[model samples]
Target chain A: MKELSVKELFEKKKKDFALSVITQPRTLNNTISEAQLNRPGMALAGYLDRFSYKRVQMLGETEISYLQTFSDDALYERLKEMFEYGIPCIFITKGLSVPHQMEYLANEMNIALISSRLTTEKLALNLSQYLRNYFAPKRSLHGTLVDVFGVGILITGSSGIGKSECALDLVERGHRLIADDLVKITLQNNTLMGTPARDAGWFMEIRGVGIVDIERMFGIQAVRLRKQIEVQVELMPWRDNMDYERIGLKNNWSSIHGVNIPVIYLPVSPGKNVSVIIEVISMNHILKTFGYDAAEAYTRRLKEEIKRQSRRNR
Target chain B: MQQKEITVTNKLGLHARPSALLVKTANNFRSELHIIMDDVEVNGKSIMGVMTLAAARGSRLVLQADGVDEDYLLEEIAKLFESNFSED
Candidate 1:
């Protein structure tokens, strides 16, 4: 996620951000709003959504503003013509003055009136990059990731409860590690991806230990740069008083952002080998994806044996 | 027509560097090159197909070559993969 202000977004691009594209506030008679408004891009795209029009306006900000140079009446007529056909947002570079008339009206119409002190080239580069992001496909997720059985296992938990320590144990098991703690996951185009923080890959600072690197002693095979995260496992402190998913018939799931990943729940007990269970959970995920389900297979076999015994009795 | 099954002893399996090297060696053969990882089989030319298998270190992926120079192709492919995907 890149955070960019409207002015920062249109840094140097002039062709698209000129007055001709800006949907000027309709002020046939009087004054309007005070604060500046940043409008969504779709509003601008809607301005040119129709056909039978080809217009290109070059917004050169460094030039002495036309508003300052031309007569008030002449500028008014030019501004009116610019908006006559249908316009989007008007971007002014280097923080030029926006006559109170345009600003007030722009705010009312929900048109973005942006300005930046950046020179033309800088503004152009910035605008191009921002536009790229405007069209890039994306989805975000909430989970913690670690390498298990050569697969990235994203663990989801409610706030805090040893998800990091379990990942640390898995890292020590000679399985390469990916991300720990907060895992910033994203779907680029359609492929799922994840990356551990620069200083955070194998290091676990669990309240008492401060920092522990899963590499130095475990060697290079014990850590990885990035992995296609394919599984999600949730850890909960063991609750003997509560019920756990036993039959595996009701099937459970946990979604990270919009992308739904395979989920498995494991109750954490002091004596339980969580790392081993997590490993089997991942292998089970692989099996399920390849059209084999252990639970499903068991139920089918049980039904067939019941039929076989019934036939013998008949 | 000959088929050979060689285990991917390389640390990174068939990804990036190894895929590039395998593709280079496969391109040299007059026989069409194909790789089978478990039930999935794909052209040796496609790097994505080779990688999607997610065949980790020590996993075995079968290689098959079919042409008049099949024996030469098999031996060369074997020799190329025998060394871990390392330049040395």
Candidate 2:
């Protein structure tokens, strides 16, 4: 199917992204998706970041009566100033009757006015969750994240594949360990991010070693609270039949949730340098993301030399 | 306009990841895609609907996509299932 324009995509998903509240308006234009969801309890304020454009401006309607004491025209002018700043939609609480003019303006602007009868605190929790999924980034890699050699490497493989051991080694070497085993990964915006358990910190449970706490042994500086999982090091069993990439040519992207994070297959061998290989892989991924392809560069250089040799022979 | 039945051979079954992939692929076409499992017809584009069926590995599913691109869409899905569902 053809790709939809940003406006079209927004149109389909905007309604679901909202909390059911009544519409209020300032102008009769009925032209904009900007809205002012007013709630004196200030519940939806938490979700204001992603739905930042969907202006659910929290205000009590009684406050409007206070402004009305000044003059009808003055009250309208004041509300207009608040709206020009920006709003996708607005929900007002207390179920106060909206000004007839504001209602007409909300309908004209398409600023979706929602009046939730719930208390501000209750609506905040509900609306925050309602809007969270839309703002939350999908696609997260499950692995122990470590920043080895200044590279964010997420080590993944079958359970009991020495993933914890490799991370512990990296930590001992003065590298930072983000999470050891059962990393909590989440996406905010488009980036694949990572974090260790708040309670456990970077402690890892190796079958033989028991729960060896890395932060205590390696110091706080040796651990990072969170890191972006830039590179994936997938540990696979050493199988003769399984085809491992001898040459790093085409890249691999492991789909998490919906986002595909770059993945690398690091076959677990008896004495392979897992940490070192993973570090190099991360650096290589960073380089590639910045436009340097190591394999392609090598191929190009080799081709140049071959061409030079042919010219000399001629 | 076309309909065919095939077995889901993926080891993980039609869980979150597979269901999402199927839905995303189906959404890319104009055909109205539906997956029938255990005599239950479910919309392929609805992630929650397709997931509710819980069709695991070796589970037979009837697929039907009715639209202008029905034939082409079904062909791609049939090939995708045949190539990637079973042991490679």
Candidate 3:
């Protein structure tokens, strides 16, 4: 339910999108709540039954051509009826010529009338991309995200559990680091996309080594700007009496902002080669995704062998 | 569930373009579809999975579908294979 004011959107993307405001509404504070951009095809035809007035209206060649077919009187009446809904703004795409009546009515209603040289499809694509990023639900997670064999794994644990050290090891093994300390996660279409926190510099803090710039330290291939997190790895300090799942029959999952991601609890102990274990974990995830569950297959084969042994005994 | 085995007849096999086409086709169906190559089976509707197959020419793969429209989904996937994914 976050609102992005139209004035701010224009200020940020005007030059890049070649947007020029023909007429500004009395109030420059009009805001867009949704990322969806409406073409207003149905509304232009005077059908308001299913109309969503909150969306930003776009007028393209098709809509302009339809308006041209109407007589002056009919056009005026139609435009009047449409503007009566108090829609936010109208963007004329493809540098289309806006009819005089359209501008007059937009100004009369104090609606923002804007024009862009980009084609309708291009404009729509750009606007949708920008708005999706702006309106996406985000969270700042205290973890590290890395890509191993194309699987994005987010490593989380209590402070000073060597999360960054493990990530650094993974980078040395050719895995790509996405975010180091604070991971910025955004849910896009049921997928969690993670990036480094924007405000925090792209640096990882090693207890003794201070902050290390992952990108500069390991070249471009060692870092990714963003990646879709597919799994979570929680590093727990080894305990003497804690029970851990030795058999992989039951896999754990963690839900982040309503999206369930596969999780693995890795117990960190001295001289355990945790980095190699994390690599295997990623490879195992890939195999499981391909429907090849190693543990299940082994269990099934073992049961079949036991059956055969009993038959031989008989 | 319905399934059919088809050979990759496209000259380039299931690379980026063909994988994209296959994924697009799979997405049109409401049924959940999977592509099995050898022992590895991946979601038919995912471009990444389809590309991961790296299936070459003459690579035989199985298309499996489960849901209300499994029959229709199999038919459509089979048609795409017969047409060599329109790559000719």
Candidate 4:
């Protein structure tokens, strides 16, 4: 529910975007709820049916040239209707001259009008990417995230369940550690990226062994700033009563912020090398992405052999 | 369990593309697929594992498959090796 004001965005991105305000300075206080930008070509062309008021509108060459077709009176009326919709801000790209009527109406309506030297495409791409991170939904998870064979695996379990210990083992094996203890995850472009929480210490606490700084201990190659999480590995206490998946014939998934990620459960018991298991899981994820499914292959072969046996008997 | 010994005839042995193709073809069954070369045995369904075999041209590998379609899986793998992973 956080809001970004026109003034903040302009001030933050001015250096990179070279943006200059064209309307009254106070109009920069207007806020936009959406992270996405819109080029309201249709709205400027007298089509207000799909006008979005909560978007940061951009005027490119096409829109500017189209507005030139109208007489001063017609332009004034059209722009008036458009600004009355309460658009958060307008950006004229490619250093285009803001039409006199447009600038006059922007000031009259108190809507912040801005100009940038970049083309519409470059500005839109940059602004959207920047805004996406600011507006993305995020959550902090109690887990360890590691990059195994280029796959991001989030290890989650109860406290003192050896999450950090397993991560250490993987790190020793050359996999990169992203975040230990507290993983801050965010959904970016449908991919879940995880980072270390600002408050959490860079070191991980191991019972009886104490804290270990992964970067200091393993050098720069063993730590990562952030990673796109591809799988979730949950460590559960082993129980004789529970039936764990032995064949991995069916896939399991966990959802965070509506993004579904593959999940695997590894039962923790004495002498079980959970770190190696996690590494295999990461490798398996890569294989699956390349259209290889060992479990499905087994089932398919089973069905084929069964059919062949029945045919031979007949 | 089904097992077969096949020599890698491809000009490039098992490089990235061939290893990927072999892994893809190996995963289409319900079985534990393994590629054995000398002292090492790696999961056939894993590209990294398969690459670890480092099977060069003319290197013989033991293709071991355990599950229902073990025979079909081995046969398909054999066909791929025979075709040199389709890289003439």
Candidate 1's C-alpha runs over 4 A off are: A1-143, A158-160, A190-192, A197-201, B1-88
The CAPRI class of candidate 3 is: incorrect
lDDT of 3 by residue, A26-107 (tens): 6346788888899989988989888877888898999999998899999999989888887877788988888899888888
**Runs in model 4 lying further than 4 Å from the true structure:** A199-201, A209-211, A296-314, B1-88
lDDT of 2 at B11: 52
Give me the TM-scores of chain B across the candidates.
0.87, 0.89, 0.95, 0.97
Tell how far residue A125 is off in model 1, in angstroms. Answer: 17
Best candidate, lDDT: 4
Name the best candidate (by TM-score). 3
Error of 4 at A14 (Å): 2.4
| Tens digit per residue, CA lDDT, model 1, B1-88 | 6899987665445544566567666666678878897788988766556545555555677888888787888888788778776643
Better of 2 and 4 by lDDT: 4
The candidates' DockQ values read: 0.01, 0.01, 0.01, 0.02
lDDT of 1 by residue, A143-188 (tens): 5677787678887776566777777778777677776665555554
The alpha-carbon lDDT assigned to residue B84 of candidate 4 equals 83
Candidate 2 lDDT over B1-88, as tens digits, reads 8999888666555655556567767777888999897778999878767766766566788999999999888987887677654334
